[model samples]
Each structure stands twice: as structure tokens, then as C-alpha cells.
Target chain A: MRLCKKTLIWDTSIKWLLVKKMFFILLFTCFIFDAPVAGKDIHVGKDHTIQTIRQGLMKAADYDRLIIHHGVYHEDSLIIDKPIEIIGKQGAIIDAQNHEVDIITIVADSVTVKGLQFRNVGTTFLSEPAAIKISKCKYVTIQNNYIQDCFFGIYVGNSRHCRVINNHAEAAFKEQVSAGNAIHAWKNKHIQIHGNRVHGYRDGIYLEFVNHSSITNNNSYDNLRYGLHFMFSNHDIYQNNTFRNNGAGVAVMFSKKIKMINNHFVHNWGGSSYGLLLKEIVGGEISQNHFEQNTIGIVAEGATRIIISDNRFTSNGTALDMKGNSIDNQVVRNNFLVNTFEVVTNTRYNQNQYMNNYWSGYSGYDLNHDGFGDVPYRPVGLFAKITNSIPAAMIMLHSPLVNLMEMGEKVFPGLTPEGLTDEAPKMKPYAYD
Target chain B: MLKISAVILQNLLRNKAIFGYLVLLCFTGWGMFLYESQPEKAVLSILQIVLLVLPLITLIFTTTYYYHSQEFLFLLLAQPIKRSDIFAGLYIGLAIAFLAVFFIGIGLPVLLFASGMQSLFLLLSGLLLNLVFIAIALLVGVGVHDKSRGIGVTLITWAFFAFIYNGLVIFMMYQLSDYPIENLILVLSFLNPVDIARIMVIMKSEASALLGLSGAVFQDFFGTAKGGVVSILALILWSIIPFWITHKMFRKRDL
Candidate 1:
């Protein structure tokens, strides 16, 4: 009986030992199959085993870092499908040799391109060619790149959480039809485009159907068209950017909840140019902007519930050209200095409000010494009204006839639009930061 | 004629009123340039002076001078001088003296501070304004017999050109607001030398604002080199017509 019991105990112990061994084998196999391998570094240069970027990309695994050394790679249509980081050394150039193809096409998520220079992607009318084209990407970073003379620079489409920072994109094309935008994004979300300088493009920074994007500290100048063009973009914030010498200046159309603050719009003097053109926009905030020497400083057409405050309009042709359809707009606490016509509107009745603004042409006295004029100042001159109706009458500008008509209108208050006066005009200009 | 004009210019240059006018203009021109930070703003202020003060002062001064210089005129008539030569001499003397004062007073400051094509246009228009008003003043002086009536006529003429004609134009524009009066306004602007001068200066300086739709019409007419030449010719005709009438009236007058 004792021998039989000892045999049973040994049997049970061997079964338990078998169970332990099986569990360890299972765990070891799982570790071997599921654990991530450490990413490897692939170098591409004249001396490296992988001499070209295409070879480097081919040999690279997921999450590998491709280090491209300082040399001009005459390559085009280089597609990056794997999630890899491409770090270009100083003087690293990817010359597309005027090819009608994208230089670097990124198609994966979490792909980073840094410190590369792209050149000479030729203009294409049939297809959308870009220097660095990103499609269907997320967490993609395109930073510190220089792209010159390309059709479209850094074109991103259907991207989310992408960053395009510190990029300098320039083109020398004269015609607007031939040139493309420097930084173009379509159907993007959570995009951060900052510290970019774009010049001589059709549009400097353009976004269509983009939401929750922020464009800051960009200097966009001398573009053939708008410096920044927004179409159907919502909840976007653009601040501290300068739009100078652009054809129509910055146009925000079909947008909602846009915040344009602390921007400088200067020298956009042309027949139809505006410092800021807001069309079909709702609930936008434009504050602390400097509009100087523009043909028309701020043009609000079909805009509603826009708060334009604390802006300085100096030496503009028409400081504010509020169209007839614009309603519920508030223009307050602004400084209007030396503009040819202060406020010109197409409507006979004003639905907007202008309050606490300082006008250089305001000749009313502040008898109460309350820093507000006793008399409400009418910004729309009769001649401005005449010019609005009969554009040919603009020849009568600064004429003694116009002056007399203006004086008569002031006394009678009949010709200009009704209720279009600054009720509390400021005695002095606001001190902007 | 040259001898008579030389004497008249010497006699008028010694007048204290002319010197005071020079000082006043100097103070005004320099003060405007110093007060305004922008040369454009200063130009606007100087424009007001040129438009308002210059015409009034020139009209009053010339009419009074014409009346006050009756003895000198009789003295010149008693000599071997032709009546046309005497009239030519008087107009030439007044023109030279006033042009010199205006050039030195406003023109020099403009050249020093705000030297551009715009400022040059301002100076040109201002000089032409002085000549037009001077000729108008001579017409009144030669046509009217009474002293108060001549001065009165000069004042009326200045008022009509400077303020009343503009009021009439505004009235006409308001009455004819429905009609396309752009060409009509352009035609009316030519009739008044003050309007022409004002348009010339303002168009050059404020071309950006004037490049709008209706402004484009004026800009197309005036912004081109052809437009500029036409406006100058119009002003020259304005000056000559009044002076020619004055010369005709003076030649036939029984002095």
C-alpha cells in the first residue's frame, strides 16, 4: 500500500512539472513572436552600402531612421510607405530635375521628414505635383525644409495631426494660373503650420475643408494671389502672420469660428485688394491687426456676427467697406488714421455697430472732457456715397464740390446711410501693443 | 512794355503787404511741414492754404493794387507806351511778383521736405491758380469804374469760383443724381480753375483711393499722361481767356 501511494504522488508531481514546462514554452514563443525589435539606423551616401535613398528606404524596416548625408540626390517620385524618420544632414538636397512628379511622397502614418531641401518639381496642369506630398497621413511632421520653384510646396491632403513648421517655400512664376500655393492642405484636421515664409506663389498658405488648424508666425508676401486663403475651414486660428503685397490679401471665405489676431496686413494696394476679406463667414474674431496702406482695409461681405476690434487702419483707401449683406458686425475700439474714406457701406441702413473708435477725420469737440466726443461722428462721407453709386464720381474726390456736398450732408444728414455713425468716438487713438 | 513792367515790379516788391504776405506764407508752409509727421498730411494742409487763402489774397491784393496804381498807370499812359503794352506790363509785373513769392514761400518748402511728382503738381496748380485769379482781378479792375464796385466784383468773383460755384455744382449733382453725370461733372470741373487745380493735386496724391470703379473713369482720363496734358491746357486756357478779355476791355477803355 505504501509503494502504491508513493507512485501516485510521483505521478501527480510529474503532471505538475509538465504543466510548468508547457507554460514556459508558450511564454517564450509569445515573446519571440510579439515583442518589437529595436529599430536600426540606415545611412545613405556615396560611401555607404546603400548609396541611394530608394535603396535605403527599401532596406529599412518600420520605425527605422534613414540618415541621408550631405549630397544632392537627383531623385523623383520617391514613395515612403513605411513609418520611418528621414533626417537630412546639412546641404542635403533632393533635386527632382524639373520632373513632373512629386519629389517625396509620404503615404504612411507617423512619418517624419526633417531638414531636407527640395528643388525643381516642374509645373503640372493635369496633375497636382508637389515637392513633398503627404496623403492620408497622421502624426506626420514636415519641418525645416526649403522648397523652391516647385508647383506646390508641401502639399498635404486628408491628413490629421500633421505639422509643417519652419519651412521656406518660394516660387518665381508670374502667372497665377501656372503657379500653385506654397503650402497647400485639403481636408486636413489638427494641422499646425507655423514659422513658414512663403513668397511669389499663387497663394501662400491655402487650406480647404480644414478644421482645427493653427497657422502662426508665417510671413507670406508677394504672392500672385492671396497670402492666406481659407475655404470651408472651421475653428481655425491664424495669428502673428504678415500678409504683404499679396494680390487680394488674406481671404477667409465660407469659414466659421476663425480667429485672426495680431496680424499685419500692409502694402496690398490694388483696385480690388483688401487687407482682410471676409465672405460668408460667421462668428469670426479679428482683433489687434494692423491694416496699413491697403486699397480697402477690411471688406466684410455676407459676414455675420464678426467682432472686429482693436485694429489700426492707417492710410488705407477705404478703411472698412462693409457690404449691404453684412449684419450684426461690431467695429469698435479701432483707430482709423488718414484713410481716404473712413467707412463706406452699400446699404442705406446700418445693421452693424461702430463705437468707441478714434477717427483722424473726426472734428467733433469733447466738451465734457470724458475722452469721448459729444457729437456722434459720421464716417461715411457724401462723396463716398456718391462714389458707391456712381463710381465715375470718384474723379470728384477732394474737389471743392465734394467738400461742399459733404458739409451739406453733415448739416442735413440725408445723403449718407442712416445710423452709420460712431456714437462715442474716442478723443485719442488707442495705444496698441 | 518791359521797362514799364520792370518799374511796376520794383514798386510792388517794395510794398510791405507783399513782404508780410511772404512772411505769413513762409510761417504757414514751414509750420505745416513741421507739425505733420507725414509729408502727405502736410501736403493736404498746404492744399487748404493754396485753395482758400491764396485765391482770396491774390484777388483782393491785385484788385487793390490795380485801383491804387491809377496814378502810375496814368503816368505810363502819358508816355509813348501803347495801351496794350501798359496792360501787358501791369499783368506781367503782378504775375512775376506773385509767382516769385509763391515759389519761395511754398515751393521751396515742398522741394525741401516733400519732393515728389505730387508736390511738383501742387506747385504747378498753385501757380496756375495765382495767374487765373490775377487775370480775373485785372478784368474786374479794368471793367468796373467805381473803386468799391471793382473790389466788390473781385470779392464776388472769388466767392463764385471758390465757394458758390461748388455749391451750385453740388446742387446740380444732387438734383441730377439719377442721371449718369460723370462726364458732365468732368465738364463742369473744367469751368472752375480752382476745381481743376484741386483735382490735379488730389488725383496725384490720392490715386489709390481714386482707382475705384468710378474713380477708374477719372483715373483713366487723368492718370494717363494724356490726361495730365489736357488738364494743364485747360488751366492755361482758363488763365488766358480772362486775361484776353481784360486786355480787350483795357485797350478800348477811355482812361
Candidate 2:
């Protein structure tokens, strides 16, 4: 009876081991055959069996990856409708061959295109042929792409949680009027644009109806129009961006809750050019910005409720030109260094307040030793006032008579708005590097 | 011409105005360098001061000298010197004296503190303005028969160039802003010698950044090497025209 029971236990143990082996084999086959739920990589190259990226995309299921090898592929347009990742190897080239309306159109969410070089997209004004256009897509990342001579470099429309990272976008055309914006977005939210080198476009970064976006570390130069143009975009933070030699540095209009920080605007010298053109903007903070050699540093027209602080304005034609309708704007802790005009306004009285600033042209004494000047610093010069209405008065920019008028007005402030004065002017510049 | 020039130089250098000008310029020139930390800015401020004050001094000094030295002119006229030689000697003597004073007074400090293209440009413009104003002053002296009237006209002309002209331009531009007078206004800027000199100085310096669209246009026209050559030529013409008028009037004068 004991021998029979042992044999029965041995038999059951052997059956259980066989059952485990069969289960693992079934899981292995499932992993190898059914890769829909689990994503896989499809290799595409001239040498690979899948020669085209379009064929790779067709074969790839949702959430799969297309690993493209280094080769030149002449494709007009590729419509990506699946949640896939298209990563190009080093020196991977995508030649649009000048026939496509759009180079790479992303229609699905959670798609990524990285390390690809796109070139020679045809032009049509009716619809801009972008090197990469993400339409109605979310959580998309387009990074490390070098796009040259496209109608538009990267166009994002109605997309959210999209990041455009480290992309170099440039055009070879001489006329910027025919070129489009490098990185353009419309009606989008939560977008991040950083580390972009954009040049020779209509505008460097154009955003209309965009919100909650962060733009940082972009070097935008040589654009025909404004380096950056934003209209109706709100809750945006732009920091650590350098704009140089553009038509005008940046124009922020009809936006609110913007934080412009630590940006460098250099040599935007032109007629009607400004380092930062703030128009019809509300509730923004512009701080730690360095504006050097611009026609006008900050031109505020119809701007309201903004904090302009910690900015350095040097060698500009006019430092702060408040046209009119500017209300409750506070300029504090700024360094105005050798600007032609410290402040110029056309209003009856100064609607904005100035405080705790260091003017290189400041003549007041610091008696209290508290680093604040004893006399208030009034920045509205007589020449500035004259030029507000008469631009031709600028010809006499160095007339001692105008300087005399300013000195006289400083002693007795009446003709030049008496309300415009920095009550606490700093004896020295703030700790700015 | 040489002997007369030496005598005129001795006579003018000993006058109180030159001494006063020397003291004022030295004080302001070094003071600007010490006060403004930026060298370019010091040069610019000093340039503006020179533009405003230099012409006034030149006008006053030249006109007053011409009027005050009536007996001396008569003495020189009685001598064996040519009429052109006397007038030319007097003009050159006065111009060189003032130029030397200004050069040492303003130019030295600028060179010591900030020696660059900007400083050189300022000095050049200052020199040009001084010569131009001297010519204008001499013209007014020869044009008017009376001393006080000549001084008055000179003063009025200086005021017009320095103050009233800019005011008029402002008024005109404000009135005509609706019209596309961009090019028209730029051409009008060259009408004033002061403005022309200012364009030369400001276009190549840091002040060019302050010039907006008008500045851009001015730079496109005046910021180039060709622009510099043209502007310098125009400024020379400004001085020459006034000097030629003065020369003609002095040559035909009865005194």
C-alpha cells in the first residue's frame, strides 16, 4: 500500500513539472508572435529588409518603435497615425524632393521623432509645408532634428504636452517675407520649446493662442521680423533666451501672466526696433533681462499691471518708452546705464511707478549712506518729450540746449510730467554680473 | 600773412575769453571723465557740451575781435600787407588759437581716458564745428556795419541752430507725421551744420543705437564709409560757403 502511494505522488509531481514547461513555452510563443500589446522595434534601412520608413511604419503596430538606419530617403510625405517612435541613426537624412505638401505629418498622440535631418521642402503659401507638423497630437516629442529650407520648420497646431528640443531650424532664402516662422504654435497648451537655434525666418518663435508654455535657452537671430512674436498667448515663461540682430528683439502683445526672465537682447538696432516690445500685455513680470544697443529697450504701449524689475538697459536709444494707456506698471531695481533717454512718455502724468533703480546718468547725491540717492531721480528728459510727438527732433540728440532743458526741468518739474520720478534711486547697481 | 597771423595770434591769445574758455573746457572735460564711469559716455557728454558751448564762444570771440580791433585793422590796412593777407591772417590766427585750446582742453582728456574711434570722431566733429562757427562769426562781423548788431545777429544765429531749429523741426514733424515724409525729413536734417556734424558724430558711436528708424535710414546713408566721406564733404562745404562769403565781404569792405 505504501509503494502504491509513493508511485502516485511521483506521477503527480512529474505531471506538474510538464505542465510548467508547457506554460513557459506557450508564453514564449505569445511574446514572439503576438507583439501588439507589447511594442517592438522595426528596423528600416537600405540594407535592411524593410527599406523604407513608410513600410516600417505600416508594419509597426501601435506603441512600436521605428529604428531607422543612416541613409537618404526621398519621401514626399509620411502620415504617422499610430503611437510610435521614429528614431533616426546618426546622419539619417529625409529628402522631401520638393514635391510634398508636408514632409512629416503627425496625427496620432504620443509620437516621437528624433535625430532626423529634413531638407528641401517645397513652398506653397496656401498651406505651409513644414519639415515636421504635429496636428492635434498630444504628448509628442520632436527633438534633435536639423531642418533646413522648409516653408516652416516645426509647426504645432492644437497640440498639448509637446516638447521641441534642441532643433536647429534655418532657411537659405535671402528674403524673410517669403519664409515662415521657425517654431510656430497655434491654440496649444503646455508646450515646451528649448535649445533651438533659429535664423532667417519671418519670426523666430511665433505663438498665437498658446498658453502655459515655457520657452528657454533659444538663440534666435537674423530674422526679418521680430525674433519672437506672441499674440493672445498667456501664462508663458521665457527665460535664458538670447535674441541678437533680429529686426526687433521680441514682441509680446495681448498676453497675460508672462514671466520674461534672464533673456539677453543685443544689437537689435533699427528704426522702430526695441529689445522687448510690450504692447497690450497685462500682469507680466519682466526681470533680469539685459538689453544692450537697441533703438528702444522696452516700448510699453497699452501695457498694464506688469512688474519690470532687475533689468539692465544699456546704450539704448531710449530706455523705457511708454507711449500711453500704460497703467500700474512698476519698474524697480533696474539698472539704466548710459541710455540716450532714460524714460519717455506722451501721457499727461506717469501712470507707472519707478523705484530703486540705478541710472548711470543719475546726478543725485547719496547723503543717507543707505545706497539711495537723497534727491529723487526724474528720468523724463525734455528731448524725449519733444521726440514723442516729433521724431525729427531726434536730429538734435546731442544739443546742449536739450540737456539744459532737462536740467531745468529737474529743478522745477512742470512741463515734463512731475509725477515721473524715482523716489528711491540706488547709488550703485544691483548685484548683476 | 605770416607776420599778421603771428600778431593776431598774440593779440587774441592774451584776451580774457580764451583764458576763460581754457578753464571751462579743462574743468568740464576732465570732470566728465571722472564723473561718468563709461569712457564712451564721457566722450559723448563732452561732445554735446562742446557742440553747445564751442560755437557760442567762437561766434562771440571772432565777432568781438573783428569789431574791437577797428583801429588795428586800419593800422594793418595802412601797412604794406595785402588786404586778403590781413583778413586771411586774422581768420587763420583766431581759428588756430581756438582749435589748439579746444584740442588740449577736450581732446587731451578724451585721449587719456578713452582713446578709440569714438573719441577721435568726437574730436573731429568738435574741430569741424569750431571752424564752421568761426567762419559764420566772421561772416556776421563782415556783414553788419555795427559791432553790437553783428554780435546780436551772431547770437541769434547760434540760438537758431542750437535751439530754435530743433523746436521747429519738432513742430513740423508733429504736424506732418500722417504723411510719409521719412526721406524728406532726413534731407532736412542736413540743412543745419550742427545737425550735420551731429550726424557724423552720433552715427558711428553708441548713440547710433538710440536712433530708431530714422537712425537706421541715417546709418544706411551716413553710417557707411561713403556716408562718412559725403558728410565730411558736406560739413567742409558748410564752413567753406560761410568763409567764402566772409572773404568776399571783407575784400570789398571800406574799413
Candidate 3:
């Protein structure tokens, strides 16, 4: 019995020793074999002068730079499942060829896709698959490339801290069902869209269900719809952008805590178009922007607690038409020069502040020369007030008899919106250099 | 003529390839319906597939039918009958056989899911398209001497009508961009059979909003009674041209 017990213990000890040896061997093999998979550089388009990029990216790790040469590389949808830098040299073309549903979908972190041309996407009415779609990704930079004739060019949704800079997107202007937006961002946060030229899309850059993003220095023009559009997006800063010659310049609706600063809104003239159409916008700042040659400059409806200060509005038709049940907003220290109609306040404008703004037609004098007018200037005109209530009443605007009636009403304010006044308006223009 | 059609139809009905295609269509149509959200959803999802898959099936099936019936056609020609009647019988007989399979495959589900006169219209339109395409295939089979060349001509014609035609139209518009040619554009739209059919069916649906406001104007003009008459005439013309050409060629040419 003693000899049998000793033999069993020895057998168990041998089994444990073999297991320990196998574990070490596996650990060593993994550390060595994974080296190439993690940090390898692959060159594309090696045979031709323009290198062909091979794409079967299950994952990208430890690879510093993936260099793609210039050639049309047909791939199905490739997922950048890990972190990597993809650099295209001499205009490499990543043609998905509409092979699969989507193309170059990224769900990884710290990915950079630069200098590539993409086209020929499949269109499914049920599925809006883009050429380069990034979902739930972070620190992704899509910069310095041209994308043309795609269904949707670069779509990023549910992503954070992404930078879409200096890219061009032009869609095929076919049937409306086939054409899609250039850059579509929905349910996204903390994105920076800067210095991109987007044109001839359904919308140039669209932000829906977004928050805390910054759109700066982007030129959005010649699009079918609004140049830069946002809905249900809040606390976002849009500054230093040029939106010109689109169907409509820019529209901000159902949003709050927004800032529009120092942007150029120019020549977006069309039927029912505006430099900025604000609907249901609340608690925002609009400062130092140039609004020129738009049909309507700064159309406001159902917006409250917004500060409009130190902006230049020139050469626009029907500037600042307030059309809804808004209260307690301030329009201060802005220059309104040669606009067709300065202000049209339709609803009760009792609680709103219109002070310290420079109107080029301001006849009030500054006794102290402190840039504040001694007598208060009313920006809302009597004829404008009437026209807002009855759009057909606009026929009475240029009539001398209607003009005399407007002057009489302004002298003794009757039947207009009650207590609409601009106390402490500016005598001199609010200058910006 | 009736006896000739009976013999040709019975032989075609027995073919395994035709049987497979019938099964494939039924399975695909059923799968499309099952996967879709609603009748309208199925229509929108399968519109492109209908354009591509239906024509392909018609082309291949009709071509094979024409080739297989050649020997039988010669035998029938040896008897006392008009060539026109023989061509008509073979063409109509093959069409009836293919239509039976297509109705069982694409039509039954369409009946189950689709609603209103539009659905009936879609069914009739699909059947008419199949007839036209089958007629086109038969014309090619009669025109080309080599079987491969016949198939090639049919495929190239399909490609021209399907893919390149629209692109060429757009290119033409771009080339003539300086001209005030909206009415001309409307007239030119009738030149392509696919566009006419697409516009007709789409105008019937609520998804006409997909074309935005410009399409509304087109619909206002093209969805009228006059437009409907014109479209039907165009489709009939499309069918008649190839048949007439083939009939004319076959009359003159040595077999």
C-alpha cells in the first residue's frame, strides 16, 4: 500500500511539471509571434509606381504608419479595428467599388486616414452606407483628401474628439435618392470640424443630436440644402466659417447655449433663405459676424435669452425679422447698415432689450460722444411691425400715405406690439477691425 | 400554329434550367417580402433588384428557349404556315410559359403584400416589361447568326439601356447646359424605357417626396392621363420596334 501511494504522488508530480513547461512555451511563443502582427509596415502599390494597398484589416496595432501608394485598390468594407496611421502617397485611390455594403469602417482609436480618393458606392434606400464611416471611435483625424461621387462621403456618428480637417466631398448630382450628404454627424460629441471645403451636397456639414462640438474656419458653399445645419445640437461653438451661395446659409433650430462668432455669411440669396435662421433657439451669443447679401439676416422665431452684439449686418434684405413668441432677448452693440428692413417684431416684444446697437440711419445725437445716444433709438419700425402681422400689408410699405401713417404711429405708438422700445441705443457704430 | 405552340411549350416546361430559375425567383421574391418592413418597404428595397434580376432572367430564359426551339421551328416551317404566325406562336408560347413561372414567383407575393390599383399596375407593368424584354431577346435570336453573338448583343443592349444610357443622358444635358431645354428634357426622358417605368411606378407611391420639389413638377406633368397614355405608347413602341426589325430582317435574310 505504501509503494502504491508513492507511485501515485510521483505520477502527479510529473504531470504538473509538464504543464508548467507548456505554459512557459506558450507565453514565449506569443511574445515572439505577435511582434510582426503588432508593429509591421506594409507597402501598397509596390509593383506599379503607385503602390497598391492591400486591405484585410482585422486589427491594426503597433504599426506606426501604413503607407499606401497611388493606385485603385478594390476592397470590400475594411474595418480599422485597432489604432494605426494610414498615409496615402501621391493620391492613392481606395475604391471600395461598391463591393460590400460599406467601405473603410472604423471602430478603433487614434486612426488617421489621409490623402486618398474614394468613389463608386452602392446605394440602398434602407441603408445609408458612406465611403469612410467611423462609429464610436475616438481621436480620429480625417484630413487632406478628395472624395467625389459617393453616396455619403465621410460619415462619423457616435464618435468623440474627432478632427475632420481640410477634406473635400462632392456627391454625384443624380436623382435625389442617390445623392447623400457630404459630412454627416449624428449623436456625436466633442468633434472639431475645421478648414474643410465641402460643396454640392444635400447638406455640406450636418450636425444632429450633437453637443459640445466646435466648427471653425470651414467653407461650406454651393450645396443643395443649408450650408451648415444643426438640430437638437447644444452648447456648440461655431466660429470663423464662411457659408456662401448655398440654398440657405445656416439654420439653427431646437438648440440652446450656442455661440455664433465672427463668421462670414455671404450671398446665400434664394427664396425664403437667410444668413442665419434661428427657430426655437434659446440662450446663445451672436457676436462680430459679417452678414452680407442674404435674403434675410438673422431670422429669429421662438428664441429667447440670446445676446446679439457687435455684429456687422450689411446689404441684406429684411434683417432681423422676429416672428414668434419669444421674450427677454437682448440685441446690443451691433451695426445694422443699409439693410432693406432693419427689424420686424411680430409678437409682443415687451421684455426684449434692443440697446446700444449702431444703426446707420440713427438720427439721435451723442452729447457726450461716449458712443451712446442721448435719446433712445427704436430699431423696430411701425411699417415692419404691421407687415409682420399681415404679410399682405407689405404692399403698404413704400406708399407715401402708408409712410405718413407709420410716422404718425411711431410718434404716438398705438396698436403695435405693446412696450417695444430700445433704450440707450448707440449713436456711433460698433466698430470691428 | 396552335399545335406547334403546344409542342414547343411542353418541351420548355420540362426543362430543368427553367425549373431552377422559377424556384430561384420564388425564393428571392419570398425572401425579399419576408425581410421587408411593409409592402411599400419591399417595393423600395427590391426596385433595383427587379430592374436587374427580372431582365437577366428574361434574357437568358428567352434566349435558351429560342435556341432550343430552333429545330422544332424548322420542322414547323416545313409545314404549310405563315412565317409570321410561326414566329408569333413560338414567341407567344414561350412568353406564356415564362409568364406562368414569373407570376407564380413574383406575382403571388405581390398579391399578398401590395394594395390598391397601384399594386395591380405594378404587376401589369412587370408583366409587360417581361414581355418586352422577352420579345427583345427573341429579336436578337432571330437577328444574329451565331448563338454567342446573339447572347452578346442581348447583354450589351441590356447594359446600354440599364447603366450607360442614364449616364449618357446626363452627359448630354451637361453638354447642352447653355440651352433652355426643360421641355426637351421631358421629351428626351421618354427615350429610355427604364426611366419611364421608374417614374410611372414612383409617382403612384407616397415616396415621390424622394425626388424633392423638382420631381413634383415632373409628376404633375407626367403622372397625368395624357402622360400615362404617352408612357403606354412608348413602352408599346419599345416592344414593337425590335419585333418589327427582327421580322423585317428574317424576311429578307438567308437562314
Evaluate residue B75 in candidate 3 and report its C-alpha lDDT on the 0 to 100 scale: 82
CA lDDT, candidate 3, residue A223: 81
**Over the stretch A1-433, how does candidate 1's per-residue lDDT look in tens digits?**
9999999999999999999999999999988875554477899988788888999999989988999998999999999998999999999899999999999999999999999999999987899899999999999999999999999999999999999999999889899889999999999999999999999999999999999999999999999999999999999999999999999789999999999999999988777778889999999899999999898998999999999999999888899999999999999999998888999998899999999999988879999899999999999998888777656556556765467668889888987887999999998888888
Stretches > 4 Å off in candidate 3:
A1-38, A46-64, A96-100, A172-178, A389-397, B1-255
Better of 1 and 2 by TM-score: 1
lDDT of 1: 0.89
- Candidate 2 residue spans exceeding 4 A from truth: A1-43, A46-49, A59-67, A173-177, B2-20, B63-80, B111-120, B140-157, B164-191, B205-230, B249-254
lDDT of 3 by residue, A1-433 (tens): 9999999999999999999999999999999997765666656675643333444243234555677776677774777877887877886777767653666788888898998788777777787788889899999999987887777878989999999999988764645445678888989899999888888887888999889999999998888778899999999999999999887889899999999999999987754567898899889999989998776788888889999888888766666877657667888878887664777766654667787787754567778877688876666677666545334233222333344556677677776765665667776566588
Sort the candidates on lDDT, descending order.
Answer: 1, 2, 3
State in Å the error of residue B254, model 1: 5.7
Query: Across residues B10-63, which tens digit of lDDT does each residue of candidate 3 receive?
Result: 987898888997898788677778865345546544455456667777887788
DockQ of each: 0.26, 0.35, 0.01
Q: Where does candidate 2 clash, by residue pair?
A: A271-B212, A271-B213, A317-B210
TM-score of model number 2: 0.84
Determine which window of 10 residues in candidate 2 chain B has minimal summed lDDT. Answer: B207-216
Q: In terms of lDDT, which candidate is stronger, 2 or 3?
A: 2
Model 1 regions more than 4 Å off: A1-51, A69-72, A89-91, B1-6, B14-20, B23-39, B81-89, B103-105, B108-117, B143-160, B163-191, B224-255
Please, what are the lDDT tens digits per residue for candidate 1 over residues B62-146? Answer: 9999999988899878988789999999999999999999998999999999998889999999999999999989888888879
- lDDT values for all models: 0.89, 0.87, 0.74
